[model samples]
Target chain A: MLKLISSQIVSMNDIEEEILDRKNRKKSTNMILCEKVIGQILEEITLSEYDLIICTGEGELGQTYSFFSSLASKDHARPIFFQNSLHNSTLGSVSLQIPNIHLGISASNGFISYETGIEMALASSSTKPVIIVGIDAYPKELLEVKERIYGNEIKLKSGACGALFLKDSTSELFKSHKGRVLTDICFNTHCEAPTSREVFPANGLEDILRKLSQNHTNFTVNRPGGDSIVYSFES
Target chain B: MNPVDTISITGHGLISPAGIGLDALWEKCLSNNSVIKNGLGVIPKSDFSKVTQFVENSKWCKSIPKVKSKALYYSLFSIMSAIDSAKWIELNKTDTIVIGTTTGNLTSWEDSLMSYSLGDDKDQTIESIREQSLGQLSVEIKKTLAFTGKVLITSSACSASTQAITLAYQQLSSKRSVRAIVGGVEELGKLTIRGFGSLKLLTEDNCKPFDQNRTGINLSEGGAFFTLERNSDSPYLLRDGSTVLDSYHMTSPHPEGKGYQKSIHETLELSGLTKESISLIHAHGTGSFHNDQSEGFALNAIFGNQVPVISTKGVHGHALAASGAFELGIILKVLETQLIPPSSALVEQDQEIDLLLPRKPLEGKVTNILKATLGFGGVNSSFIVSRRDDA
Candidate 1:
């Protein structure tokens, strides 16, 4: 059984503040948001206790734009920007901050990226704790591009959601709290939800965390293109 | 045997700089000729255009609108080839598709960005931007194939496809899906070329891995796919695999190759195999100094000079995320032919590297082969493939 130890959600506003306040901010907005949310969750559990880290998203689009912009202008792109432009760079940052975790994965499935991360975490055979983080940050520069692409129907937000999961064991960090047992989670390509919602990579996991906070035991989150992630929980 | 160990590689397809299809790639490997021209492992324009035209004319192209990205074309062509090789007319709704990619539709994104930068928004379209999503690769595959199951995309740099294969193994082992279409695709683009160039990791000459005069990697692009299932009758069985992080550096690997060692150890432990059981070690060997050195120390510590090792980056170039899948295809050929291809572009071996590097094709009683790949940000993955008869 996989048990949710603790989870944190960071809004776009908070991520913006963190990005602005950092003096040495060479990282991408997605990396900054991931570190912020994962940092909050680490306050509850020791970093060393986690055995795996799974980062999910399309990657640092802002950095990608910057790298391309540099090239378009006949300028040498920064090596750091090139390195951080990778989707897995966010996971690399987390691994650097917390050196104990030996396994790290960066996955992306667009709006259902969070669900994909959850599925991967659940599928892992490791019995130790795992940390799954879903992050998305749309740079202001890409707003026009996004507008042309997603149109008005889909509202893409910039934020991050992080969760700590333990398999077949309860951690002392959440011993006093009543942890929600994640009974089953799977991705369905067929849409069964009543209504369609905005497409944000981190929203599905964010919605689940909100529902769990309200003491809701069972719920489902549907993605765009008739895909849905069904979540079942037990107290 | 464990159910996880039951997963087999039923079929595979390839599109590399060497050529298209598994036969072309294997022939190139055996010929020991470096396909790297002008410092890039690129698919010949003829092969590229041929596959594009074939995909456009194929029945799979009827459903979706015209795709502008070469990455999508490569992926579709490879998947169709894999399914054809598997001899499956239809796919089950419960089947899953996992793709590993370093750059997904990057060429499209580059064009859009360039146009946008020039204030020319005429070419930018919704479909083009949607295609930029790494996940969109699998979605397009699903639409063309009409499968209503789980879709995943792993974008973990160089080891992305290896991780995808490992995830498919886990999914089938856990009974989440009975069969999976697993592969990795990368397309050559300005972003990767200039990006690696800025880091001074690109070589103008041939990429010579583990060679004393090794300079840097030659970036390449291609795709390879495999049909994995629980069928025991398959010729090749995916023994097991592991992915581990170095947690040491962003671009450079641990000097001692600690992460790679751990990954190899864990894969062996889980697969119930030992060092002596592996017939060949397909090293990542990007021809980059740090990667080759790190992997060299790791392999030396683990296998000493007992296991024969080879790196084919010189022939096909480093396809980044697709390199592991390309090597896996080569490994399958190695098992079938009972011959190990020589490491291409090796003039003199690096004295510091202690492992045995093959300079010529060796015929042996091949059975289990270990394939390992290390990517940027210290992601290391290792897996074993064995002949079914041996099992």
Candidate 2:
């Protein structure tokens, strides 16, 4: 089983402010939401070594790959990245700085896209820690739609990219102890109202995991609310 | 395992230059003719005209309010077709809507570029176009259809819609309580045209797929959608689907078509069917030298000379994200009618490839069919659909 070891939340305020500080910016959204969200997370995972890096968001790896290509002054870009821009490029970008890294991309849509990507990362290897980044700053137009959905008075705040460093219990990192799957997620997309109107947060994620670590057991039940909707079980 | 709960393709609606209805599209398919020509428009304005005649002919065009962007038109037109085909009522605000596109409103981008070059306040133009492009289309579709379900708008260059289809299949097969409306939509825009032009990949004339004289692909705009159900009275059954990342390149396929080969094998494997069971193959023959050569090599490797192969781009032009779904719709028609549509408008055939190309509609019972595609960003997908009669 894989356990989320440590989670890091880097608000766009830090690095984005850095990138914006350099350029005389006129573009309404200076956040470079995609670049900052993807780049900053890459920066966080630079120290640790991992078997694979998985990036999930909306869109292909072209722009993300190019950012890494320029950062790494390789004489020629990897044909693999140039051809397919495999999933590892996300990690490869940082791996260029980190070395001996393999990465893969899982660009899914909406919230589940991020969740599924995390699930994959956790399942990849029990011993190695996988970095998962889920950061989506609303697109310009989508911002307006979010505004409409949230209401005119409310502005959809840019989403923060949440990076979780996940490792399997079997890894040497956790050899002395057993780690268990914290959340078994399945989506209920058939609500009568929009999820925005119906979701309740799963605040117990951390506490439940801690309790399971002590008990080394399993429990399952249906719960509503939190960042996503579904049943949660802990052992 | 009797009829292991297959994904139901309850409804789909398509409006191409061929016509507004399935019958109309079938007529064009039977005639082996395409209605797409270079479009007539002002922004990124081209005299080349890859317009779908049905778009010009449909009442939907007259009903839609004039919008600044053409992407909205394509989005709306395809939505209407999908709604009509699916005959589905409004979702409880929880159904998932996934759409794919390469150039979301390229016309607007073209306008922005032209305006920016002229030192105009491109802010509003850029903002407006970007809004209506991909996410905007999903919002509009949600608003128009009054859908309350979650909306997922994917734009993964060429693999956009295929990803949508693949995701939808995974969700349903995973036993998730979800219904997905998945497909791709693309309207030709100057950005893509100019981009392809910059890359020297667009053909000056209509594309000729799988031909030795294949020049390059022609960019066009079209949208096709499938309303997939976990269980329902869909006209056909989508037995299995799969997506494989070539991890190869961003722009070109592996010269050997290894990615495509992997996708085919996985798709067939997922469907629990052998290649010998495939009655027909809908290939992603973009008429480009590289795509044709790579796809040709892949087909030869998989089916040898026996399986009949067809590429619709010769008639429909290359529809970007929607190409795979468009080809799937054609396969559905073939399955329903048991008639092999004529491989449209190919001027020459690649002699090195050993496969049958139907010059005219052929009568044959096809229980299972394969539709394969290779898109930009090294995303390749193949879907296996079993005829409803098979169930």
Candidate 3:
């Protein structure tokens, strides 16, 4: 069992002003989203308390678009774009801000990225608390390419969600949130909920965090291929 | 006492720049010839075409939709080779598949994007885009293999494959899955070439890991896959592994390799082994100044010039995400042959690097081996692979 110590969701709308006014605007949207979500979580708990940080997303489509667009235009592509294009770049950027934690991992599995992050967190044998950040940004520049590929416009929005999980043994720090605990986590299981499209790859995990905050007990993330990941919580 | 449930690496397949198959790779490593040409470790065009044609001709290709991703082809070929080597008649639905990659299908994406930019959007199809998704790499393999258990794709830069292998070990150890097909694949792309080049981390000549005059790394491409099972009667057993982050820098490692030291110590402690038990250490050794210097500092601090350390990046080049699997393939060969391949292109060892850097193939009673990889995001992963005496 794992305890949900704290969580926060940051959307593009939440950071629109910062995105516009930032001096280092070269940062990818995914990086900004990660910083936002992690910043909120840090407000609740100090960075030193966390042992592991895991970031999950589909890809850095925004940065990829910029890099490829430059290539397409025969313009000199910025090296930072290529560097930020890596899926793990967001986590790397976060590492720069929080320089004390020693273990950061990035995972991606398309729409199942959030669940994958949770699974990795649960599978980790670390006795200390873990932070899982689910992040994806809308690739506005790739919308045309996406439409050409999918034969229709796909709906996507930039959003990031983070959750701080502590194992039952390590729940002393957040003993007050005993009811907000994960009783079990089942992956690749059957799903009763209908598959639906998400605004972002990590929307499912974000929705679960929201529902859990509202005192919901059970949640199911319906994967595209009829499989599901069920997260049971004690409310 | 309860019986130990060891996760053994039953079989593995390699498609490295040296050539295809384990024999070719091992022979290339022992030959002391760097496959890197003009500072790039690319698969020979002939071998690439051969494997592409082989994958296309395979019976499994009939069901899946045709895709233009070379990474997919490399992954399928390696997965099939591993399955064949493992002699698994059929895959079970409960078995899981995990793939690690840095740039998945980016070559195809580049073509699509270029075509689209040139006012020809023919290549930008849904299937093509989906095939390029990092997660879709494992999905494609799962579809080809017809497995429904669980699919995971890790894209943690250089440490990706090692993390995948560690995840598989954890799953099998926890009894969540009975078997796992785990590995990583990478294809040379302009993005990676330019990305590292932009960072000024690309070497102009042969990569010489731990050398005093080491410049940087040579970008390489390939794939390696392995079949892992619990309590298997295989010679190589994946004893345990651990991953940690430096939390220091995004592109650079902790100067003293603090994260690496933690990862190695944790892996050894979990595997119930000590540093002295490790016969050889496969250092990440990308030939970069900071990487080698930091890793050298860490290894020296831990082993103190006792264990023989070698980096094969000079031989096969840095496969990036696929490097861990590639090195693991070499480690398996080391266990079988008891001959450790020399660190290629090593002229003069850096004075600061005090560990033993073997320049010639050393034949010895090799036992347990430790493999460590450090990635772009300060992620450090270490795992131990041991030879099963009974096998």
Candidate 4:
């Protein structure tokens, strides 16, 4: 079994909405927002030892593959970007930063993509650590669709992406007494509820954290029709 | 390890060049009749003309109702046929509907491209059908089957269906659910056509597997589904199945067939069986020179030349992600009838390859058989199935 040793969510590091307004940036692209988060996360952690890495996305239209592809090689002299880039280039880019890494990508349209990445991290035969990233930025022209799904009129143009380094619970990579507990993850494809509620993807992760903080006991949160994330205490 | 002594294939639906029903296709296979030919020439009310040029000379094209788009037509038909087969059980008896499709209405993209080139109206654009993405497919399936269990859609390229089958088996074996409708669907589209063309792997004629003169693969479209149950009276059973990643190449197989052999060996080992016991091997013979040569080498190295091997690609053409499930449906039919289909287009065999390329359909008491498939991203999978009576 695999466990997450380290996890990070990249968001607008220092750039405020006021800064964007001052710059007169009219379009909101989640890819750029993800770039900010990725920049911050990379600075804080090292992913050199992991065996497998995955990058998932809902941002940076058409730039998804290239953004990751550019990170494939660490060489600063020249940057290589190709058209029709692969779906998992984010992971590939990370792999370039840490050579000898197995990489994959799952951009399927829902929470299952998240669950799938975690499943691979947990199930991989590699004894080394694995990094899983979920990044999505606001779609510019498709704001209405995103708004309908996310359910808010707030002008938070910047999107955020998070990363987790998963390993076996027994692995030496994770520092003792400093870790996130993953309780259970379930994906419901055919949800039966007549009127499905707006269960944001973040709710899945947040619920596990909130449950631990409040009841100090196990709790369950349904993502409804996709993957549900959870965290439990290391009892 | 899950010991599948009780799981069985209770029901299934098939739509191939042989026609809409499983029995119809089975009868054709039993009679050793070829449903594949050059072309249907003129199919009525079909968007067949829209993509007919893809398989112009190929005789077998799995016909679904003419939807506004071809890809959507195939997926909708497969789902309907699966729901129809699931009808064998009472409504709401089982709620799990898992679909495996690689090209999720990709034909929509192809049509949209054509509309763009022809300067068609934006109102007439194929974007309307783009909602038929893989995610939305699950929603549609849930509505169709009225199923209440989990619905999973897998799009792992060619291994899509095999993974679906394995997932379904896991769900049932864990006692989470007793029944599942699992299969795959794929349709011909310009994107795939252009991709394969760029790869220079498209065959100008019917696909000829294992033949020394085999040129390339013909891209075909269709859907196949099997209704599996933990306990049933079905004649066939899934003995064991496993998947392994090559981690070697993104697009090509390991020259030595290491991953393929590993997957097959592990499957046989898990099934507690030997290669000699396998009555036949349904190979992933797409008529591509590399695919046939590599697969032939793997089968030869493992099972040797004794076991008879056959390919259905010649009949159904290469259905991409749907090939594995379609092949599974065919294998189930063979086990039920105790006869194997003949080599449709195979004439001369490569002496370097050690597989039995029989000219006529072989009849035997095939108690156990193996079906192997390798897909893009080094996804290799094999399934070992046993006859119910054998158990």
Candidate 5:
């Protein structure tokens, strides 16, 4: 058995808190969201207790294109910047801030970043107090598609960052915590977006947080497909 | 430590320069054909390097439906073939799908970028953007298969598929899902070609793994997938696996494969197996100088001369993330036949390295085999597969 100890969501519109402002740190929009997510829940889950860190993304497009494309440019590329730009670079930020977790991993299976994060988190739960992070900027163009189809003006964040601290369900911490919870996260690749709800959440993680807060026993979030990744929750 | 969970690999499918389907992959491995050919005549020449040609329209690609893009065609073709071989007698919504690729749809994205740079229509750029990201590949796969189950993608460079397989086995071990479709793919593209060529990592000669005068890698395109059904009637069990990041360098590996040693050590501990029981080892022999040295030192330090090592890249070229999954298909064949195939394209083994590359096939019962890969971003991954019937 596994349980989520704490969950945090950060969006472009909402920064979780003041992240470590660094003068030399080559920041990425994806990393910014990750910083905010980890910052919000930094104290909730003991950093040293975590042995595994799994992150998912669209890919490390931010650093790859910006730094790698012109690696031989006149400006001269910094090896540290290039090193921190890989897909798993954000996990490095997780280490800088937390510094306790040993193994940090990044999983990129495409748009299902959020769902995939949970699946991997569940798999590594035996290594108790695992941190699963999902961060990506949605296609700002996706908003255009939504508008062109629905003809409704909506404010959608460009991207989102979410983190869930998980531990074995049989663990003592899981038994003690009475916080909001997520379970049975079923990803339906075959289904279409949820037509049942006219009102929508900001993004993937936001939708999950909304359902948890609203205390909805059952609901679906629209993904690449109509309700492609559907998960049942208990509050 | 607890006993190894031993996740079973009931079925596997692959499409590589070796060939398509399990039988073809096995046959190619058993044969002495060198899949790594000079790509100067076939694929577009790289302006940066002499090694530009690669496997184009491989014999396997002919069986699949033709698509405009190689990435889409190969990913879809390999995945479908895998499920078919699994006889997936049943695919439940509870089953999870996970695939990894080093560069997904990158070739098409490069073309899109070029057209836009050449003043192609803005709509053309937008059309390309739609399919540029790795997500586009999965969307096409999901839409075509109408698979509603949750899908996960992983990219840790060359070790992406092995990491994905690690996750899949963990999912089954946790009893969170009934089955996991675990695999990875890589398609040849100008971006990778030009990119690697720019770094002088592309080899014009047939790649010789662990050879004395070995050059860099030969980039090939292909994919391999396996159906990891729990408690199934499968011979091979995914005994255990691990991933460790060096944070050392993006393109270069750790000098001593420190993180790689940790990954292998942890995985062996998890499987509760020692070097003696291990029958053979399949390495991520990219035929590069530094990579082989680093990996060789790690293997030598771990199992010493007790394990006979082999690299399948000489047979299929380096398929990036697909190599891990592709190599597993070959490992299944190795276990099935109890024969370790020769390391293809080996003329002179690197005497500096302390590992053995078989010049001829070695015959014996392989009760347990380990498959390992070292990827960019300083990612090192390794997993063991065991026979379920083993005592």
Candidate 6:
């Protein structure tokens, strides 16, 4: 059985709580988003014992543009602000901050990023705790690009979410601590339309967490390209 | 409960510094000569700065959109050739597809930024920034091949593909998927060039792993793919794969390579093999001071001087995330020839490292091969391929 030890959510405003390096230098928005999410998740759980920290998500627009623009600068003159501007930066920073974690993998599978992280956490959790994190920020700049191009209707916000998956034996201590226990997790390529509200990459995981809180229940997280991964829980 | 633990690699496709197709690649590998050197790319850069790279320019290369991300082109060509090579003509909706990459479609990403900055706002379409997520490789390949299989893209700097191969082994081991295409693809990009340059990790000279005077790495790009299934008359069987994070640093490895040693041991255990069973060792050997030093210690602790180590960077250069998959082709060659290529750029091997690096192509009865890659952000991966006795 797999159990969620602790989880946290972070939004754009959370960056205000951080005192970043090079105070005078600009902290790329993605850096802020990643650092905030990683910082909050680490606060909720100790990663020193985690066998794997699986961070899965396609980066949000802010970080994407930051890295891209830096690459596009004239004469290669943009002094690199972020060492790793790729989507893996989230995993990179998390690893640097918590250097004792046994292993970490950064994966991007479009909308299924979080579910993939959860699955990897379960599959590799026999030996030690696995901290699975999903983070993405729809930067204001990206939204602007979308609006200018597609004329978007619904507003969007930058957000991140993460969970710590521990084996049921050790996770027994958190049975009553508002965390959820897993009875089984199933992944399928056959398309199953979830009769549920659609949520974007980083924000919608709460639906699974909430449904799993019931005494016995199952939830489906639909991924892009019409695939569904069902997660069932029995407390 | 009755499933055998072995996973077969039916076939492979590759686009390397040597050439295209598996046979073309083996020809170069057998020669023990490097096709690496400093040169400008087909696409122009203002600085016109030249660096070592393994390039392929042909009709196949031009089959894609010709965007900034050379990875797209590399992956497309390699994946198609892989599918054809495997002759598993049909990609069922259930087949697993996983790709390992450092930067996905970086050229297109940089192109998008350049256009937007230059007032070409129309260029910022959904497709333009698609690669930002680093999932673009699979998206492009799936659509191009008309394959409906599920896809996963794993990133861990240079060790990306080896990790993907390891993940495939786990999936196959668990009976999750009967068939999985697992490998890595990478391309030279602005951030990779500048990022490494900023970190002062690039060697203006040819990268020489294990050499005492080694300076740094030469950034390069390539791709290779292998189809893994339950049973086949393939040349080699993927025995096991394992990943261990050194948790040492963001840009460098642990001084002692503790994580690397853990990964090697784990991989050996999973393969149900021992250090004695491993006939050859494929070293990451990026020629960087920290990387070689850390890896040398790991090799020493695991194999000591009992086994031989080979570095392909001298021939292929460093393909970043694609390096692992790209190097797998060489391992395939070694499996067939039972002869290991010597260190292409080694000169006066480092005294600190007691590991043996064959300075010339060495022939032997190599069967079980261990290929290990250590990446940035402390990711170390190892995968072993052994000849099936029954085959």
**Which candidate number has the best DockQ?**
1
Candidate number with greatest TM-score: 1
Candidate 5 segments whose C-alpha is farther than 4 A from its true place: A7-27, A43-45, A49-57, A64-86, A89-98, A109-111, A138-156, A169-178, A189-203, A228-235, B1-6, B39-68, B117-121
Candidate scoring better on lDDT of 1 and 3: 1
By TM-score, the better pick of 2 and 6 is 6
In model 6, chain B matches the true chain B with a TM-score of 0.90
Q: Work out the iRMS of candidate 3.
A: 2.4
- For candidate 4, write residues A11-88 as lDDT tens digits: 445446623664323223333443354456556666564443332323233332232222223211111221112233
Question: What are the per-residue Cα lDDT tens digits for candidate 2 across B1-391?
Answer: 1355778777776645454445666777678776656521112223112223334454434333334355555555565566656776556544566676665555554454344334454446445433422344544455445455655555555656665676566556654426777777777654455456656687776677888787788776666777788767665878655555555554678887876798789788877899999999988888888888888888888899788888877776777777776777787788778888777776667787666888888897788888888876556767888887634
First chain of candidate 5, TM-score: 0.71
Tell me what fraction of the real C-alpha contacts between chains A and B each candidate also makes.
0.71, 0.04, 0.64, 0.04, 0.39, 0.39
Each model's RMSD to truth, in Å? 2.4, 8.7, 2.7, 8.8, 5.8, 5.0
Give all TM-scores, in the order shown. 0.95, 0.70, 0.93, 0.72, 0.83, 0.86
Model 2 lDDT per residue over A1-235, tens place:
3554444444446555644664523121212433354455456445354433233332322332232333234323333323222222232233223333322334433334454454444323124555555444443433443344334333334443534354554455555433344455433433332223221111123223444546644443222211233434443
lDDT tens digits by residue: candidate 6, A1-235 = 5677777776656665562446514444555655566567677655556654445445535544665565565545243443545555556556655556666777776667776666555545135666666666665556556433322332445566766666746444445445567756565654744444434454446657666555446777665445577777764
Candidate 4 Cα deviation (angstroms), residue B79: 4.6
Misplaced by over 4 Å in model 1 are A15-17, A20-23, A51-56, A169-177, A190-199, A213-218, B1-5, B56-65, B123-127
Question: For each model, chain A TM-score?
Answer: 0.87, 0.53, 0.84, 0.59, 0.71, 0.75
On lDDT, the stronger of 1 and 4 is: 1
Model 6, position B331: C-alpha lDDT score: 87
Worst 10 residues of 4 chain A by lDDT: A75-84
Candidate with better TM-score, 2 vs 5: 5
lDDT of 1 by residue, B1-391 (tens): 3543588898887899988898888998888888889999888879888888767676645465355577887888888788788887777767888889998888876766755655556644434655667777767777766667888888889999988889888888877787888889999998799889989999999999999999999999999999998865887888668889988888899999998999999999988898888899999998999999999999999999878999999999999999999999999999999999998789999999988888999999999999999998889998999987744
User: Model 5, A1-235: lDDT tens per residue?
Assistant: 2355677765556743333456424666666776666767765655555654545444545554444335424333444444444566566555455554555567665445666666677566345566666666533424443333333333333454555555556667767776555566666544554433322222356566777677776677666434455566564
Per-residue lDDT tens digits for candidate 3, residues A1-235, read 6787787888879988768966648678888878888778888777564654445545788787777778778756678888888888887777777646555678888767877776666666666777788887757656555544433324556788888878746445766554367766666644554434445666566667666767678876675434577788876
**DockQ order of candidates, top first:** 1, 3, 6, 5, 4, 2
Badly placed stretches (over 4 Å) of model 3 are A21-26, A51-56, A147-154, A174-176, A183-198, A207-219, A224-227, A232-235, B1-3, B56-62, B115-127, B389-391
Q: Which lDDT value does model 4 have at B123?
A: 47
lDDT (C-alpha, whole model) for all candidates = 0.81, 0.55, 0.80, 0.56, 0.67, 0.68
